[model samples]
Target: MFPDTPVTSAALSVATRFCSPALLNHCVRSYLWGVMYGGAHGIAFDDELFCVAALLHDIGLTDAFDSHRLPFEDAGGRLAWVFAVAAGWPQERAARAHEIIVLHMRDDVPAADDPEAHLLQVATSWEVVGRHAEEFPARARADVLTRYPRLGFGAEFLGCFEDQARRKPDSAAAASVRRNVAGKIAANPLETHQG
Candidate 1:
């Protein structure tokens, strides 16, 4: 496992124990975007905790997704809650995190007061859109722009991906994701959501 560096070492270790490099890279990319959002917006947040939470937010998916469990569903939430509590996360945060992860697929869920939830949404959106862009065509790009407008971090997150794509065009994964992201940017140049 990577060094703790102000975050929970044990959590990081457990969260990443079975993930693939592509998944890990996806997590890093999302976390970096969260860091960028924090830096530019000057939000008062726990950087270390946010970073760790953003990185591990999907860790429970190893079991949850595999078992076809829906975290948003009652049974899924209970299963996820139990797993998170057993995994050593504080009860309060675990309950909240379980809800967010379970309902992450629901676009209508209201944003949580917890800043970590916002950061997690920003990070997860970028990771998913970026990772899947290669398989999707330009027509699908509009969905990302439309779906994440309320996220308030979409444009900045896209800019970051754009910069990375421009700097490293040879990156198969980055290039694939950036293709659609670039289209999203071109389609909506004036869009910048508020955090």
Candidate 2:
């Protein structure tokens, strides 16, 4: 379960409204993965901040929030910043949400510098391409997957990134496409594991 605050609730509402079924599951699973990883690793982070960030991290990938020029993560960060401010968060805290959301797309967020961002980055990567998948307990992974399910997320996510890359060739998504991330997603061990 995630934080039950009004802000967190609003984040989930936005996700449910805009995201495809598979994308919504990916967002939720990323949060669950982050929480479980934080608990297992003793890395402390604000649950509310982390949960809201995770739920809205992929908002820019949705039709409602996608941008023609900006990277999806950057667009999504601004959207999340507005949502946080509207939910009565202080500007500083709202900025933190923006930071976490924007940083989730990066590969090198240091946990000591930004635990929530670091966790979100790793968790989302684990959910998508199975990076760091072996670090999480198999049982926890099974339960989360059972509740949310992959639901063809691999192909769906690859399509999203591919589209983003085509639209914004200078974006991080384009870089991912250049790296053949689609192949990696398809061959992910976590996606094929029977746990």
Candidate 3:
């Protein structure tokens, strides 16, 4: 359930312009999954911030935003920070959003302090790697997938990561791609046909 606020709309527009259809769908599904996970965990977070973070999390993977030197996650976080500042969000809120985006790739997000970051981390993990999928209700998963079909997101995203790795061998994505490309690709839930 994406909000219809101006900020949310702006983030979606930016994502749509830069991200492929499959990646954009993944972003939307990431938000839905984050919200669902937060609700299930009884965590109270800023839904709007979470929405923006989810929509823009993988933005650096887009050609327009990709930084050959910076890790894709870091590039995305920096881009989000600029976007939030440009959108008239307060400096502190923008900084928080930046932190959330940057830390989403971590194995353990510091959720004890920032529940929003934790939700985004787990939500992305669930969408990308199929982690904690069973914890959510089956109907909710089906509804989300039905609303935003994967559309071959797994292959598309893998290709994006591979390209990023090729361009920036020292970047975090490159390191990840180097470590286990096949395993990562295999773990992608979107790669499987869900009906």
lDDT by residue (tens digit), candidate 3, 69-142: 88888999999999998998998888877888888876677567888889988888777667776766667777
Report the C-alpha lDDT of model 2 over 1-195, residue by residue, as the tens digit. Answer: 878788899899999999999999999999999998888899999999999999999999999999998899999999999999999999999999888988888767888999999999889888877788678877887888889998889989999999999999998889999999998898776677554
The collision pairs in model 1 are: none
Worst 10 residues of 1 by lDDT: 64-73
Clashes of 2: 0
Using Cα atoms with residue i matched to residue i, what is each candidate's TM-score against the true structure?
0.50, 0.97, 0.92
lDDT string for model 1 (38-157, tens) is 555565665555655555554533432332222212333454456557767688766765565544434433234656556656556544444223332344334434433334334444
Indicate the worst ten consecutive residues by lDDT in candidate 2. 186-195
Highest-scoring model, TM-score: 2
What's the CA error at residue 85 for candidate 1, in Å?
3.4
**TM-score sort, best first:** 2, 3, 1
In model 2, where do residues sit more than 4 Å from their true spots? 193-195
Q: Which residue runs does candidate 1 get wrong by more than 4 Å? A: 1-7, 60-65, 71-89, 108-112, 130-195
Sort all candidates by lDDT, best to worst. 2, 3, 1
Of candidates 3 and 2, the better by lDDT: 2
Off by over 4 Å in 3: none
